[model samples]
Target chain A: MHFPISDVTINPIYLICLGFFVGILGGFFGVGGSFLAGPALFAFGVPMNFVVGTDLIHIVGKSIVAARKHWTLGNIDLRLALIMVAGTIAGIQVGVSGIEALKKINRVDWVVGLIAIVVYTSISFFVAWEGWRTSKLPALKSKGKTEDQSAVSKDKMAFRKFTRWIQRIPLHPRVSLPHSGIKSISVWAILGVSFIGGAFSSFLGGGAGYIRMPCMVYLLGIPTHIAVGTDLFEIVVSASVGSFQHALHGNVDILIALIMQTGAAIGAQIGATLTQYFTGPRIRLAFAPLPLLGAGLIIYGLITGHHTR
Target chain B: MSRSRDIKSFLIDLAVYGVLVVAYFILVLQFFGGWLTDLFHNHRLGYAIVAIMLMVTQAAGLEVIAHFVLKLVRPKKP
Candidate 1:
């Protein structure tokens, strides 16, 4: 297949299979799947710019499929998603401009790549460690048995208490999320977390869901399913904006995105539906290795300076 | 009877997914083929509008597909 926009000749079947594999992970974990797709596209000889833009274009479509499925399962927190969008928009502007400034300094490629490697590596280790700790705890009852099994455990109680303390910070406008069972949290705190997520996403050229999903659970005390749903919802909006911006810059390869999305659409639905059968800890545990895989790719890219253009 | 219902639901899911894939391809060809390029060449705002339209349509279309699939797969009353 020849992608006109990127002017790359590649196998369409490869992209479709990659999209299906990543779509399943993204749908289940609520990440943009770009962590996998971006490197794979680059390795397939797509330019770095095209990989980022085309991945975002596909992610917008894939997230919609996954998020809609999650919405039907009563997992989405619309209010949280909407609020996060505001912060993300602002953060993306700053991040993009920051990249442009770095470009003028003639070190945008290596700088951003190095930063991504460091951040992804650190976060992957943290997630893996936390997942390991969580898995060591006693197993919960099987799915569909009872809601009581979903309650916070002793080890998690301190983290929940910390979130409660932060939620009590006397901000002017506090909001309650009934769907996620969050009593009250400061609006500013939510924006702060989302802003960081968006900044990292735009700066690193991946969907911020990998960052945001963990924060929503560990920081804001949201349930795993809700975090996943809300993260996908936000990714749909953020990735769309990113795709538009990349299109304006002539970076998006629409043909590639379209081909990939054809597979992702179906895969996403399957992955989202499968999540209903797993417990929260199990899902988080399953998600831990994804970031590690992404970090390994970034580290490889940084070491080899491959596709650093 | 239950086996027959399960088979019917599985068939419905396959059919709906096929429909979704076909609809998505048609929409992509219609909007993205030359229409988007012409719009971008002529006017910047028009290009953005078309892009937004594409996003909105894709989102709505996927949601509709999901809704129909869910409805078809839902268990029937005894």
Candidate 2:
């Protein structure tokens, strides 16, 4: 399909299939799946600016259902999510402004692509190491349940101790998230984490869950389930804010996003359902290379100007 | 056996959803493509509004329809 809005000719089928693939991954990992979506679009010859903004619009759609489901499951921390939205919106605005500034200099593509390569590579290696480290722990294996919060207290994520330090920071006007098992945490801590997540969201697209979800759990000490649910919820708001801002700048291609989302809507259900059958750490280990795959494609695209034939 | 049954039902759900998605996108998005592109270039805010509304409707609306239709077919599921 020729998407005149973005001035690209792509097979709608390819977009749909990509959405399905990423949808399953998102559903499986309980995330917005932009880690793949943005890079994949860029590799498919979409510009970086469009990839960033278009993916956010798509995420807003996907997360609506997932977030609603989590809300019903009592997995959401509404207070935390709402507060994070405030910080997230601010960060998203700043991030989009950065993209706009880059757009003026005609350096958006290579610079953003380089940043994505570094970030994706780092994430790939870190997840690989963490998944390997976590899987070898016999105590967690014996628990026979994924995301056992108590067991995760001693989990060897290398940054598990940082959560304690973050939670201990003495800031005023603290709030408790009883749902996520957080007690008396500074609001600033929550905002600081969310602000970073939002910046990532606007810069790279999707919900930025790949960064935020882990932060919510490890940095804030929220239970895994609650973090997933709450972060997904916040993705909707942040992505919407991102979409509107990006749309104003003509960085979004709605035609492409809508076509892609049709496939994601169903694939997300399948992905979420399939998760019941998989062991947790193994899934994480397998997922370790996906970001690398995306980064590889972006590299190929950068070198040759397009990975597609 | 029940697990297999569940997977089978899920596959059926996907097939049905696939058909629905193909039909809907071809009918709606394809028809409005040029017009949306015009709005995108000439009136961006309108394009953005339509884009967001279209996304939300497809997401919230179609999912409900999918589930409702699936329930009617598989009345025993509740």
Candidate with maximal lDDT: 2
Candidate 1 local lDDT, A1-309, one digit each (tens): 665556677887887788777877766765667777776776676665556667767767766666777889988899999998898877777766666566456555467656765776676677667666655554543443332243344434668777777778798699999998889999998898889877877667767676787678878888888888888888888777766776665556666777677667666666766676665655666676776676676556555554423
Per-residue lDDT of candidate 2, residues B1-78 (tens digit): 777778778887887788778877887676888899999999999988888888888888888888887876652544
What's candidate 2's DockQ score?
Answer: 0.78
Listed for every candidate in order, the interface RMSD values in angstroms are 2.4, 1.0
lDDT per residue as tens, model 2, A1-309: 789988888998999989998889878876567778888888788988899889999998898988889899998899999999998998998899889888888878888889888998998998888777766777655676554342366652656678778888899878888877778889999999999989988987878777887788778888888888888888888788889999989989998898888889778878989888885666778999998998998887787674211
For each candidate, the DockQ is: 0.35, 0.78
C-alpha RMSD of candidate 2: 2.7
lDDT score, candidate 1, position A22: 82
Evaluate candidate 1 and give its CAPRI docking class based on DockQ. acceptable
- Runs in model 1 lying further than 4 Å from the true structure: A69-78, A102-109, A139-155, A175-184, A223-226, A272-288, A296-309, B1-12, B15-23, B26-31, B34-44, B62-78
